[model samples]
Target: MSKALDHDPDHWPRRLVAVTPVLPMLPILIVCALVLVGLVDGSGVTWVPLLATAPALAATTGGPRGVLCVGLLSAVLGVSLGIRGDAADGVLAVALASLLVVTLACAATSALRGRRERVLAAVRSVAEAAQQALLQPIPATVGPFQVAVRYSAAAAEARIGGDLYALVSTPHGVRLIVGDVRGKGLPAVGTAALVLGVFREAAHDEPDLLDVVARIERSLARNLGTDDFVTAVVAGYPRDGQLEVVNCGHAPPLLVRDSVVVPVEPVRPAPPLGLRTLSGETPDLQVLPFADGDQLLLYTDGVTEARNHDREFYPLAEGLARHTGDEPVDTVTALHGELLAHVGGRLHDDAALLLLRMPARTEAPAPREPSGTVRVESCSP
Candidate 1:
């Protein structure tokens, strides 16, 4: 749904493609038609007044120079037709005067349109660069899992929003986080960036997954307002057969094992980040068996909260089962497509989906030594 100005003609917006090419030539076409009409009717004065339309149409699609050219052409043709038809001098002068005024006015309008277009292009380029830095690209494969991500911003023109996700291969293992800020716009975006910055650094420094999350929480508490907070799920794959997760008031992640879709609800729910001081409860680490041929999905509330014309929330579990496949990219792509169709082609809120799948092992992979002891206080099937 994001509408960015594209330099490629083939990728230009539908509105521009339909209107841009024909407008410039419309002036000339109209002039030729008028000449034919004059030859048939034996009267040029009546149609000569209509020639003013030629320059007006040209103003929308061309620059000042092009408008001036079309205006000159219309004037020349009018003079010739008036002489041939022997029209009154006063009528011819009035017709010529109207055409001149229209041409000058249109020329100014064309110059202003061109200037605004250039400014828009420059702003779009800056936005793209900011997005690249904020949501650094992820590779198709990380550590022992296949990964895929899909994101949508409610403000399609900006192409970036409050929803955030990041996956990194650290000394500890494959670590990731998916979160949603409390609000929208620039404030939410700043908070998302803050969380990611802390997570990326802490994931590498702290061997325990809780410490990585705690670092983000502490940072947010010091920086965020009392009313502001972020709901997030921090997860890690530290060894061969186990996965660690800490859910902080966010949507439960879906686990796919043997074609069965199940939500991994937290054993002990904790307050969202930046609100821990109010609740005084720390998040519990839930360890689940992550064997080969299993896939896990992490998403923001925007995905589950989206409503259709029937006022029904999207059935994410059913959609995932229908689209699940060996390829992570293919599965996520199908889910994202179905999501857009459910919301009538545009989501009202920001949405993000990240799929992590452990491919079936053809041969046993060498055991990886655990970096640190994973303190698992709870377990989920």
Candidate 2:
């Protein structure tokens, strides 16, 4: 059966409290009320026939054990009501038979539901493990830059998605890549994993930033389908005072200098990662002056393409400009909160944002002379 996975780990407490303790006993309460009505009315209509409702209702909220308990209690209440109302023996027998059938059926249903829940839990556990292995977390700082990243998957249960980002400090310098796969679901996830694997490996091996990008493109071309391609930006700080960026059909990264936000558009446009062969164009490496107090923000299309109810796309560049701060973590947090607010709390597609900031360099003070040792000073009169 195709149904929504309504299990949310965040709201499980509220859901449990709503359905437990009080709700499970509702069936017994109903049976008691019906018994009181039958005894008070003394009608020939025989309300004992309604006893089957107790077990049927129990199936909706409680488990198999609770359903059986409700069914047994209802049968006893029905017999008492029957005797008090002077009902026929055949009527009481039929009520008992119906209650028995309903209770057994409800018990079976509860068991089936429990099994499905277990299966869903197992699947969710495996998904979490896969997410940990595939998309490892990045620390707050890498190399000489303060970094922060935020990612959201459209599938709530599947926390990982096609959008990927990684930052590593290598012998050459700090290397990073932020990219988005062309689609969603398992296929897109596979493509994303492939790209990240190559990037991480090549980021360490290849000294040149463009060579790292080329290695990723070569791997994707061999493994990915003809139509499948990834848009990415590969960046590196191979030496002091320089930032090398290679944009492969991805959105231009926002460069923040002295709290001013500017998009670092590629000098030469290039096709996406896997489509270089078809486009017949090679990616260009652009090196910029990355002085202290300069910041760069790399992101996927998901951030820029996200739309609100009025169908207006998110203004990422403007948001960064407004929320720019000295700390990368604070800047990314503000931007993420605004993005969610813009989309009305949930994004329709995977979104990733990575911000790296170069802290202002400070000069150390000169060493002071010891106070205990008195030095003879010659003064010219």
Which candidate comes out best when scored by TM-score?
1
- The lDDT of model 2 is 0.79
lDDT of each: 0.83, 0.79
Off by over 4 Å in 1: 1-20, 363-381
What would the per-residue lDDT of candidate 1 be over residues 1-381, giving only the tens digit for each residue?
Answer: 112112222133556778778778988999889977987898977788788888888887789999999999989998888988899999899999998999999999989989998998898688677677778777777899877777767765666789888999998999999999999998999999999999999999999999998999999999999999999999999999899999999999999999999999999999999999999999999999999999999999888988889999999999999999987676876776677667665577888888998987784433332211110000000
- In Å, residue 154's CA in model 1 sits off its true spot by 2.4
lDDT per residue, candidate 2, 4-49, as tens digits? Answer: 1122332455577776878777888898888888878886227766
Which window of ten consecutive residues has the lowest lDDT sum in model 2? Answer: 372-381
Give each prediction's root-mean-square deviation over alpha carbons: 7.8, 13.1
Q: Backbone collision count in every prediction?
A: 0, 0
